[model samples]
Target chain A: MNKNLYIKELKRNRKNFFVWLSIVFGFTLLVLSIFPYMSGMGEGLTALMEQIPPEIGKAMGMDEQTWSSALGFYSTYYGVYIVVLISIYTASTGAGIISKEERDRTSEFLLTRPVSRKTVFWTKIAALFSLTLIFFGLQTVLAGIGLSLVNEGTMDWGIFTRMHASGFILICFFTAIGVLISMFFTPKKNFMGMVVGLTFGTYFLNAIAKSTEATKWIGYISPFNYMEITIDPHHAFNYWGAIVLILVAIILLIVALKSYEKRDMAG
Target chain B: MLAIETINLSKLYGENRGIRNVNLKVERGEVFGFIGPNGAGKSTTIRTLLGLIHPSGGRATILGHDIVSEGVELRKKIGYLPSEVHYYDEMNSRELLEYSIGFYDNINPDEIEHLADFFELDLAKNIADLSFGNKKKCAIIQAVLHRPELLILDEPTSGLDPLMQNRFFDLLEEKHKEGTTIFFSSHILSEIQRMCDRAAVIRDGEISAIENIQDLLKKQMKKVRIVFNPDAINRNLPIGSQNEKWHDQKVNFEYVGPIESLIQWMNESKVVDVVMEEPDLETIFMNYYKR
Candidate 1:
């Protein structure tokens, strides 16, 4: 990877990174900080939880434990809001990372420089995942701090780790899909709508699949199905699923790099 | 080794667009001009050589490196100025130039400041706010700051005023003196006439003719109009004159031979007034196109 290009890519996306980071930061803290208050209402919240439609609760990965523990409460939001928000930021960024140069017509200037297309491609990808990992790690750390501060009772760190691990894998899977999608579309296209649609659309697919026994087969098509974020002590982390998703991400990135190498930069 | 060489290089966009079977050899330190009108495949050929676009067939080399397989190394020695400049709008001229410099090795960053000052470009101004001419100036500096061995310039002076154009040409002349091989592409005839040693004429995606600039000028046809005295109406016209037309006491024709011979013929005739017109390059190209 070209260091200079990698650095420039990072610097270019700095503002967008900070914006998304703050949103994730706020959401993580809001979910965790509110957990203590919800748990204090204890039986009252449990009564409220029972009143919620079981289908709705299942769709959102929420349960009785959602009002009982900090990690359980955070896990509900983690599976739906937090992971999807981070994925949207990362996936949209991945879509635009390379295509933006073509859209802006600066590829001519860049490709003519003393750098191979391969170098440029991998450098940008390196920068992209670096941002992804940082974003994912920071949110995890923030949630960790919030969870510890709010939970007066002993918390299950293993479930917390498992939930975040699955969240990271899902985010990466979506981000790779974003990069692959950009390769097929015209550079001038705004990828935000498509990226958002793919992330939310797949999340809803998993949610609907989980809520109904009839549609459970549909969950197989979504990466979220393989990488579950529900904080259940009975279900272990999906190590095999994580490996498959990572391999798929790698394949998507390689396909994108191949297409980028051969593309004729239109002036 | 040649500075630039292409063997049957072709890039067909679809059925009839882009360049085709373009073969050229530009010698080291030679100022070779590529003359063509817009959409005449000049930019297509250059872009293919620079590896911005993959060639449909055939191959090329610049500075002894294969354009396809060795583009990165070859580009290290090449300086290209595109006709339409598009830079990162977020960067100021200094930052853009600095980022550009980072792509190569051993480039003195101070050269960016020097070139910016020389071209009267304000380094602090955002690229989005700069005028076309100012952007062109920035591009010019970016192209030459590294003192590259081969300069591929496409319509290099289009946006610059005459003064900046002159300054640009002067800078090019200086680079030429330092043994830089210039591949200049322009439709403007005067600029080619001033700088080119030899020129290749491309039209409709193919090369029609490649001739020495001196030979081309020597063979050029001039439009001539002569107003003769009434007494001289029946006199014979010059030897190299063609399509002579008589209108009362005045005659109009095209002269295609040596200027001295035409002058001598006129001196012997009873002429009251004479007008001579040098046809522009487009008209000369039209002659070739018609053939």
Candidate 2:
């Protein structure tokens, strides 16, 4: 990878990087703030949550018992929010990292430099992964602080860390998919649309799978289901799921680099 | 080694032919012009040499490096100015230039400063705010700041005013004197005539002729119009008369033969009026295409 291109991309995307970081941090803080009040309501809150349809609750990866535990409460609501936001952030930024040159009409300037197309492609991926790593670190810190402030009893740090780690892997997968999508399409809006469609379409499939045993196999196709607390209640690392996600990411990235190298760029 | 060489280079856009059997050679340190009308494959050939598009057949090289297999290394010693220049709009000119220079490790800062000063460009302005001519100037500076061994410019003077165009040509002459090989492509024939030592004319995806500037000028034809008395209309006229037009008592045509022969033919007829004028490049260019 070329260090110059990586550094230049980091500097070029500084503002967008910070904005994603803020969204991650702010979302974590907002969700963790309500933990104390929910814990105080106790059995009354459990009864009310149970009154809702069991199918819908299952679809959201939540149950009456989840309200009593801090980690479960975090997973049931805040987890989905974090995953969706991260999906949006990583997918859009990753796609923009390469496709922006085409849209902004700077592909000629950048591609004609004394660097190979492979170097440029890898440098951009490195910069994008670095941004995601930063976002994860900041969000983890914010979540830890929020949990400490709202602590009314013992909490599980191990499960929290494991869940966030799994999310990071999923973010990498999303980023790979995003960068691949950018290679096939030239218009920015169309690529962004595909990102959203793929993100939410898989999510709803996972949700529908949760509501019925007959459709449970559909959840296997959605990356979000890999870390859903309702599916893996113990939060143990799903080695098979992780392997599949990683392999797909690697394959997508290889295809993306090859396609970018051969494309006839029109300026 | 030659500065640039292409053998039977062909590129086809699906069924539409881009360029066919295009063979060209430019010696080191020579200024070669590529002239063609719009949609006549001038840009296609240049883009292929730059490795922006893949060719359907044949091969090419610049400075002894194959354009396809060794493009990255080949680009290290070459600079290109596209016909239409665009850059990161958010970057100021200074930042853009700095980022551009970052691709090469040892570019002298002094050269960048010299080019900026020569072009009279304001480096602090955002690229989005610069006018088209100003953007063209910025393109010129970036292309030459590295002092590359070869420069490929495609229609490099589209938006510049007459004065800037002249200064740009002078700057190019200075670079030529310093032994930098230049491949200049333009639709404007006069610019090619003014700046290039030799020129190749392309039409409908083929090179029709490649000639020295002096030889090309010598062969250029003149527009001749003669008005004769109605009774003196000669049925037999001299050969090499073309694009003829006849009115009631006036006749117009292009003359490509010896001037002495034309004068003798005019003396034989009762000539009322005669006018001889140099034809523009388009007329001459169209004539070549017709042949």
Candidate 3:
């Protein structure tokens, strides 16, 4: 990968990075802060859960049985917000990374340089992956702080690691898919629409699948199901889901690189 | 060795033709002009040579490297300015120029500063705030700052005022004096007339003619008008008179024959007045299109 281009990509992405970082941090803090108060009123919380239908609870990825624990509450409620926000971040970055040059009419300048298409493709991929790591790492740190502020000495570090690990891996999968989509379509505005569509489309599909037994097989097609936090087992990491995520990510990345190399660039 | 060569180069976006059977050769240090109207394939040919778009057929080479197989190496010795200029809006002119210079080792900072001064461009201003002409100045600076062996410019003066256009030509002349080969592509005929040593005229995705600028002007057809007294000679016109019109005592046509033959015809006819003038490139261009 070309260092100059990689650095240029980093500079271009820095502002958006901070904006996403603040959003995830603020959202996580607000949800985690309410956990302590909800745990204190156990009967009221239980009564509220009882009033809500089981199908709705499952659709929300909330655990009715483990709603009392700090990590359980976070994995149930705070988890969805984190995943959704990061997915938007990853998908948007992946969509914009290479196509933005064309959209901005700068491809004529960049592609005419001495750098090979392969180097350019891989450098953009590297930049996207690096941005994902930063987003994930910063969110983890802020989540840790928020959990400490409300856990009252009962927070489980092991469960936190496993949950975030699965989330990070799952984000990688979605990011690769985003890059794959970008290779086919161009200009920033159109790519963003596709990013939003695919991210939420799969999300709602996964929810729909969880709402009924007849549709559970549909969840297999959605990346959201691969990293879900299961309740009965107590926030255990899904190894097979992690495996599929890694494999799919690798395959999509390969397709992206090949397609980018063969495709024509417009100024 | 030739600075640039393309053999039967062609590009097609599926059924839409970009360029067809284009062959060009430019010797070292020669200034070559490519003239065509909008969508006439000037940019397409240049893009193929730079590997920005792969040729659908045929092949090309620049500075002795195959355009595809050795595109990276070829690009190191070449500079290009596209038809329209766009830059990273977040950067100031200085930052963008610095980023461009980073790609090439051994670029002279003093030369870059001199270019910026020649254009009267404020390097500290952000690109987003710059006018179209100022952005064009920045594009020109980046393209030539490397002192590349070959420079390809497509419609380089579209946004520049006449003064800036003259200054740009002077800059290109200086580069030419230093033995850099230039391929200038434009729809405007005057710029090509002022700058090019040889020119290739393309129409409908194919090269219609390639000739030295001076020769092209001299050999092109001349418009002829004749006014008769009361009686007009109805005798058959000369073999080379094209699209003749007859009305009252006036006759107009285009003549492409020896001057002596025209003089003989004028002497025989009851001609009160005879006017002959060479047509400009625009007229010639239109005539080519008409064919």
Best by lDDT: 1
The root-mean-square deviation over C-alpha atoms between each candidate and the true structure, in angstroms, is 2.1, 3.5, 4.1
lDDT of 3 by residue, B1-291 (tens): 899988999998766568899999999899999988788888889889998888899998899999999999999999888878888999999988988887778887777789899999999999999999999999999999888999999999989999999999999999999999999999888888888999888887899988898887778878998888876664567768998998877889998978789889888888898898888877766666666
Candidate 2 — which residues are off by over 4 angstroms? A228-233, B222-280
Error of 2 at A6 (Å): 0.9
For model 2, residues B1-291, the per-residue Cα lDDT tens digits are: 999999999988866669998999999999999988788898899888888888889999999999999989988889899899889999988888988888987888777677778888889999999999999998998888778899999999999999899999999999999999999999888888788899888888999998887676667777888888998887466788998898878888988888889899999989999999887665666766777
Give candidate 1 misplaced runs (Cα > 4 Å).
B222-234, B243-252, B258-282, B289-291
In angstroms, how far off is B174's CA in candidate 2? 0.5
The TM-score values for the models, in the order shown, are: 0.95, 0.91, 0.88
lDDT head-to-head 1 vs 2, winner:
1
lDDT of 1 by residue, B1-291 (tens): 999999999999888899899999999999999988789899999999999999999999999999999999999999999999999999999999999888888899989887877789999999999999999999998898788999999999989999999999999999999999999999897899899999998988999889888777668989999998998674587788899988999989999888999898888888899998877766776676666
Instruction: Return the top candidate by DockQ.
Output: 1
Candidate 1 achieves a global lDDT of 0.91
Task: Write out fnat for all predictions, comma-separated.
Answer: 0.87, 0.62, 0.73
Please, what are the lDDT tens digits per residue for candidate 3 over residues A1-267?
A: 888889989999999999988888888887788887878886787889888888887777765654577777788754466776798889789988887887887877888888898898899899999999988998889888888887866767877888788778877887888888878765656666676777777877788798889999998888877775443454477898889789989899899888877877764
- Give the candidate number with the greatest TM-score: 1
Better of 1 and 3 by DockQ: 1
- The residue pairs in collision within model 3 are none
